[model samples]
Target: MRYTLRQIEYFIATAETGSITLASERVNISQPSISTAIAHLEQELDTQLFVRRHAQGLTLTPAGKALLVEAKRLVEHAQQLYEVASEANDKIRGQLTLGCMVTLAPMIMPELSHAFTSAFPSTKVMQVVGDHDTLLQKLASAEIDVAITYDLHVPEGFDFVPLASLPPHVLVGEIHPFARLSAVTVKDIASEPLLLLDLPISREYFLAIFMQEGLTPHIAARSPHQDILRTMVANGYGYTLANVRPRSDTAMDGRKVVRVRLAGDHRPMVIGLVSPKERRKSRLIELFENHCRNRISDAYIPGMVAPVMEKRIRLD
Candidate 1:
């Protein structure tokens, strides 16, 4: 063979740590060994994977970026193959790559991860977080086994299993005029300045609330991070809308925010698991899928105080 998995491992380590010295430390290999492996890999591939800087570490070239994702998947799959071959029982034991929407990760990943890993102690879970489009893209590209996200803009070639439904609600600072209200309509929300979440599918979902009511938002501020948006709302910049509810009423900055339900018939977004429709499912994937369905009840989700509602959607 022109290259070995060891070389790929070394390449990945260097790319991740962004320095040969750190990669050596991370993998418990010598610095020269890491460098040699990288050189061999570059030669075999006939391309420069990284650009080395004098004391600034290494940065991935376009080629490196393209290979990193596939390399990680290959390495993990190889590890899973070994685990499966060596197993003497039916217990789940393998590497499982999971992707989650950025906003949902903090609210649900910890509990879901803990439950799944505890149920299958021999398994290793690799978690990736990004916006809806990014997670969906990874799932479509076979970069992740499954994804947890809202049922927004899901392409036709994917399977979705609804776990929970999160309804849209207005978020306001404690001192905002709407904070004390039990609920407000979309028209009320449209009348005020809006702080948009500004994520891929999520942004459209939020704006759709106003669209359904035949109104438009007066966007005052925007951010991709939910915490930053919450913090902005907490500081009274403007009100925002959201689906998932953290158990706490305070933002990351320790400022208080309130969730006021939309008074009218506002359609809620569906939170669920997504995977490619035609792909073969591993036993580990099936087990984790069932585990998610069984465990993601209202009582299980962290940072959620609202009653978990079941709104099923047939993806077939």
Candidate 2:
């Protein structure tokens, strides 16, 4: 009943890894320290939580296994309590977790997280990056407090506050003929080799554009990493369809690239903040949310090419 949060954390680490040495490495503590914490947890709970074997590490006893779930829940609740506590007074000082879609992570996280932390030096923002489905799962499990993701198949009971619209664009190398055009239609690239970003939800999102046009892209390359896809396109492997335009036009290898608006009336992906519909706002979360609203907009997104309404936005 009086066990400390640290003890529970160490206990969870040990339970998860099944070995004191592994837990020690995972939690950045000494093996003996973890062992002591586990012992303390067992003594407090008045039950043997782990069944230690001679050389096989440890396994949770039935009682221990049952308690593991509660221990995890308790630890998570403790974290939420800390975030919702006295620190909420004035000087916002607590940890805030933000989940971002994988494709946007490269262009968004570093700048956004750094700016939030820099603005509120007392606060720390931990970022988790995943594809759309993974971000949705994480948000549901309360693993991340909020998410910056596209409004793609967002389920019922979650609130999505749209921040900016990122219309899909055709990505080509500087020397590619399509790069010279102000815009290109889906038919223009249907036969051209495609560099597909093969991430969940995103793949379907891109392919559906061609589907709507009753065309199938001739995919020549696929990558999950945005940088890799850009590099492939820059090397003439194939052109790609992308929405998050990184500020740099050059690929990882320094070859220049171009973004041509994918012409016609196409549905643009809207980036937004997603969270549980009824979760009360935490000051830290609210601050970060407001920061995102200010940072990303109809006209601007940090570390990304601004909207080129009249071709003023530069990817470089």
Candidate 3:
């Protein structure tokens, strides 16, 4: 059973997009070529990878799901070989699939992408944005070279390198009562309508702060969009608890918002890089990791205003 790297690439592309046509467009190959590669791959492995549905698209079979894990790893290793060869010649050149938390993507990706690309023009960085779970899944599945996200729940097989510690802060409309206060308590914010940034692990972390204070927030509005939550807070709909703050002090509608320190030992969000614990680190991944470690700091990020802490603190 000799399966070529090209076959694996076609399989992965089809599995991800769930359509040969889309996969063709993604890999810049013809539909027939992709279909033939998949067919040959299935025969070589003696397993039907995709179930074709009329008018809809392809769905991975259980066997397909299992094979995808290994296929991605193999393809990634092949790419890394190219990176290794380039590095051996004292050049940094290869492809990198970078995954970032959805909320962080809009604010950080542009700047990080620009810096990394400009520094290493030969390196190709592909960005994949998703929630924590999706990013973790991609990391585990070898779909992405590395992930930039909050150290929410980095499971057993991943290594997290902390970049910056972001302590929780309360955001309120400029006209809101809490805006006038220097610092606010969780209980105080909980008493008012709370606009939650409801994304998987992140949602739990925010709510847990209230739980620790023995208060149940008056749930008003919830959204997966950070901007929507901010806009809601700015519009006086409710107050939001967030670790990260935008550089701009205003919302999309031009209404101003205020960031008040959460008075107490609020758990800081550790923004970091996550990669597979056991995978051989490629030169490109190492270079990119170094770029992040050097650039991302406690007091500086491209689009976020560093939280004003009374003392330099990093909460474990």
Q: Point to the candidate with the largest lDDT.
A: 3
* Candidate 1: C-alpha RMSD after superposition: 5.7
- Show the colliding residue pairs in model 2: none
lDDT of 1 by residue, 81-156 (tens): 8557745566668778899889889878888888788877888787888898888887876768999888877889
Q: Per-residue lDDT tens digits of candidate 3, residues 238-292?
A: 8988887677899989999998889899788999999999988987889999999
- TM-score of the candidate numbered 1? 0.81
Structure candidate 3, residue pairs in collision? none
TM-score for all models, in order of appearance: 0.81, 0.82, 0.83
Ranking by lDDT: 3, 2, 1
List the lowest-lDDT window of 10 residues for candidate 1. Answer: 307-316
Q: Between prediction 1 and prediction 2, which has the larger lDDT?
A: 2
Report the number of the highest-TM-score candidate: 3
Q: Write the per-residue lDDT of candidate 2 for residues 1-316, one digit (tens) a residue.
A: 6788898878877887799997887667998999889888888889999899978999999998898889878876776676766465657777787999988887888999999899889888877778999888878867689999999789998999999888899999998999889889999999999999999888999999999999989999888888898988899888999988787789999999998888898888999999988877777888899999999887878778767532564433
Per-candidate Cα lDDT values, in order, are 0.83, 0.86, 0.87
> Model 1 residue 211 lDDT?
84
Report the C-alpha displacement of residue 153, candidate 3, in angstroms.
1.8
